[model samples]
Target: MISSVLPTYNRAPLAFVKGAGSWLETADGTRYLDLGAGIAVNALGHAAPVLVEALTEQAHKVWHVSNLYQIPEQQKLADALVEKTFADTVFFTNSGTEACELAVKMARKYWYEKGAPERVEIITFRGAFHGRSSAAIAAAGSEKMVKGFGPVLPGFVHVDWLDLEAVKAAVSEKTCAIMLEPVQGEGGIRPAPDAFLTALKQISDETGTLLIFDEVQCGMGRTGRLFAHEWSGVTPDIMMVAKGIGGGFPLGAVLATEAAAAGMTAGTHGSTYGGNPLGCAVGAKVMEIVAEPEFLAAVNAKGGFLRQRLEGLVAAHPEIFEEVRGVGLMLGLKCRLAPGELVAAGYAERLLTVAAADNVLRILPALTITEEEMAEAVSRLDAAATALETHLA
Candidate 1:
């Protein structure tokens, strides 16, 4: 029988009625420590007081005013983004998927208007997960995402992230841009080497190919930086941001340099619900909190603490965990078995974790999570691993 709602998701049997900080509570008051953070969407944790206040205050004032009119809140967020990063302008969207859609169009359109319409192909990489949109799946070029969706959107060339030679070989005068994530979130938390990113920047500068980074998961204080690209000291011509940017309010944005965004004129792109006062209000609050120097430093310190703990955990459970990967709070446990087994075992321990490709179990807690919470999460993980090991034995 068909469910009332679409069954696209392999949803768990449990449901939470409320959440506070890094914990979720069922209707009967059984609490679970939330390390997944809604797949890295809840930046400030569940029902953060500041974000809740921002949303409610804006909700009381006004909710929706179409993009046809001026939106002061939107302007404030865009200005904040421009000031905090390499961007000169910003366009708001309702989700990361929408941001991906616009990034592709903006990059291609820049060349089309610059009298190079043939320069439309964008060089991408393997193990990349942009979004579920047609353009995003096309950019990934992975068979898992594009198998049934025949006639995938064209103009994307996939290559190996580590093979600088292959990346160079794939680039041509017809190449319009190079798009990739600084860290692969779904393909397992793999951070691109600094040299690889630097080489890509050189390629972009020399060939007039624009550089695009999908920082939806690794940005917004996740990688102990305002953006992960900062760690590599390389800046992309265009960047896509979402997930933690909204603090779970469903907001996304495309930040780009003026030249890159030149073709995205008034009518080039837009959305009815995008950049609404409510979403912008929440997004502005998130930026204000996350962009603070002290907050980010604390995030880095906490990340170090948690990572050290995870390293010890991995050493203690070598039979189950191969190693640890990722940066800041976006850490992953490379499981020896299917990652799903760890996720299920975590549920048994009343802890939440996310599973990803390449046999990894992702641990994406809120940036504000304290050291004590991290220790507790690690303890729970140890217990889960121990139980799984015992069951296997």
Candidate 2:
């Protein structure tokens, strides 16, 4: 049968019919432990009681309204976000890509408002996945996403990761911002070094450029923190957040310091479904839950456990895994074979994982996952690795 949707993603064969906290049930009676959590978007896990209550309560009240009127829930969620992080203001969008678009725009606009309109160039890193949007694609300079699209948007410059001198040289009078993922999720789960993040902050300040963090995939407790930048002891002038913000609902936000957001006045930008009440209501609840000190600490402890187990697997099967790297639950295995083939093998073993750039297999689990579930995931990973080891041997 013909479908209206474009053929883009290489979808998995399984169609999940129901989910309950770290487990997915297929149309058949088969159930699979879900370590993927929809690629780290389901922070609180599937069918969470608190999230269900929030959604059910808000659904009866209101759903969609034009942005012409003030959205109280949006304000509430924004307030919670500001109270928890370095941001002073937030602009909501419907997805991570839209959040990225806003971050890029706000960075350039801030510089323009400061009387330097020529400073519009945005420096991004190689292997970064900002989004599929035109400007975001240009900012990412990803050949795979940009191909077949018409002329690329101008002013985005690319540099190699960890190349401080190249990053320094790339800056010019026209440079308005330096955008990078705190952890490169699609680029193979590579975490940026604390020193590199610190240097970017310093260089941005010295060059009078805005430092932008695309925390869309790595933020919102995925890194065992509210935001990954907090671990680096550095913050960006502008930050893009999404994925786990709504705890499975689609929501995204671009946060900025007051000075940085000054240019995003009423007429500068807008989105139709950006901050609908339902999404904001759910996000507000998610923030409230994730912000608890005990909850974050639990995530940290579980992340350590998961990583240690994965490291042991890597050590035991050196021929199958080169290394296991990443912080918190957003971990990866540098593999000896093709990442896609490995992901397939894991799936066949009733385990789910994602492939990324640099031939790494991603293991991004829900932050709220239990230690027992993590142990099971480790066991399944061990089985997958042993299978690969046998194949290679």
Candidate 3:
């Protein structure tokens, strides 16, 4: 039967009707342990009571109010973000893609306001996924993403990942910003070396170019920190955040220092549904929970446990897994077998995982996942690997 939805994604065969904590259920009551966590969006797990209460209370009071009027909820969320991070100002958006768009615009406008409009080229690294929008796609400049899109947008310079020499050669008076993900999620759970990130910050400072960090997948407690860059002790001039920041709702934000955001005057940018009262109310509650010292410490401890278990898995199944990499809950199993095959096997074993480039299987569990659930997930993964080995034999 034909479906009304666009076939943009090669979706799985299963459809879940409900979820709670780290588990999901089908209509017939089959349960699956969800390590994917909707690709790291459900940081607090499914149907979190606090998030539900926040949304319900906000829904009863107000759903949305235009930007023309003062929205207290919006102001509160922005204040929380500013107080916790390096940014002094924030612009809300409906998704990470929209935040990326505005970040690019803000970078270029900064240069334009300085009477150097030619300083519009943004330097990006290879194997990066910004978004599908025209500006974001052009900034990424990946052949696979930009192939079908007509004439690529200009003013973006693409370089190999971690090639410091290449980045040095790419930057010039025309370079508006140096943008890259601190942890490349879609590119196989790669974390930029801390030294390299620090070097980039130095270069940006010396050249007077803005630095942008896309923390869409690795931020908001996914990496055991409020933001991934916090581990490096380096900050960006502009940062894009989403995913877990909303708990489960659709919300994103572009954060910038007052100096970097100077070009954004009144009427320069706007989103009708970006900072609605409902989303902000829920987002504020998410911030309150994820920013606590005790909660973050728990995340770090769980990450260590998960990493140790994964190391054991790699050692036991050398024929199936080559290595285990990544930080915190955003771990990846670099598979000797095809990642898609492992993902399908996991489905058969009633465990959910996501695949990434470089033949890696992502294990992005919710921050609140219990120790018992983690053990069960590992047991299922072990079964899946054993099944694959036997089938191949």
| TM-score, one value per model | 0.99, 0.98, 0.99
lDDT tens digits by residue: candidate 3, 1-393: 667998889999999999999999999999999999999999999999999999999999989878888999999999999999999999999899999999999999999999999999999998898888998889888888899897999989999999999999999989999999999998899999899999999999999999999999999988899999999999999999989989999999999999999999999999999989998999999999999979999999999999888899999899999999899899999999789999999999999999998899999999999888898899899999999999999
> Where is the poorest 10-residue window by lDDT in model 1?
159-168
Clashing pairs in 1: none
Clashing pairs in 2: none
Reference-based lDDT, residue 101, model 2: 88
Q: Tens digit of lDDT per residue, candidate 1, span 1-393?
A: 999989979999999999999999999999999999999989999999999999999999999989999999999999999999999999999888999999999999999999999999999989999999999999999999999997999999999867789889999878999999999999899999898999999989999999999999999999899999999999999999999999998899999999999999978898999999999999999999999999999989998999999999999999999999999999999999999989899999899999999999999999989999999999999999999999999
**Which order, best to worst by lDDT?**
1, 3, 2
Distance from true position, residue 382, model 1, in Å?
Answer: 0.5
- Model 3 scores a C-alpha lDDT of 0.94
lDDT for each residue of candidate 2 in 1-393, tens digit (9 for 90 to 100): 656877677788888888989888888868888878888899999998999999999999999996889999999999999999999999999999999888888988888889999999999999999988999899889788788896999999999987899999999999999999999999999899999999999998898889999998899888888899999999899999999999999999999999989999988999999999999999999999998888889889999999998889889888888998888888999998898877877787787788889999988888888889889888888888888778877
Candidate 2 Cα outliers beyond 4 Å, as residue runs:
1-3
Cα deviation in Å at residue 279, candidate 2?
Answer: 0.2
RMSD (Å) of each candidate, 1 decimal: 0.7, 1.2, 0.9
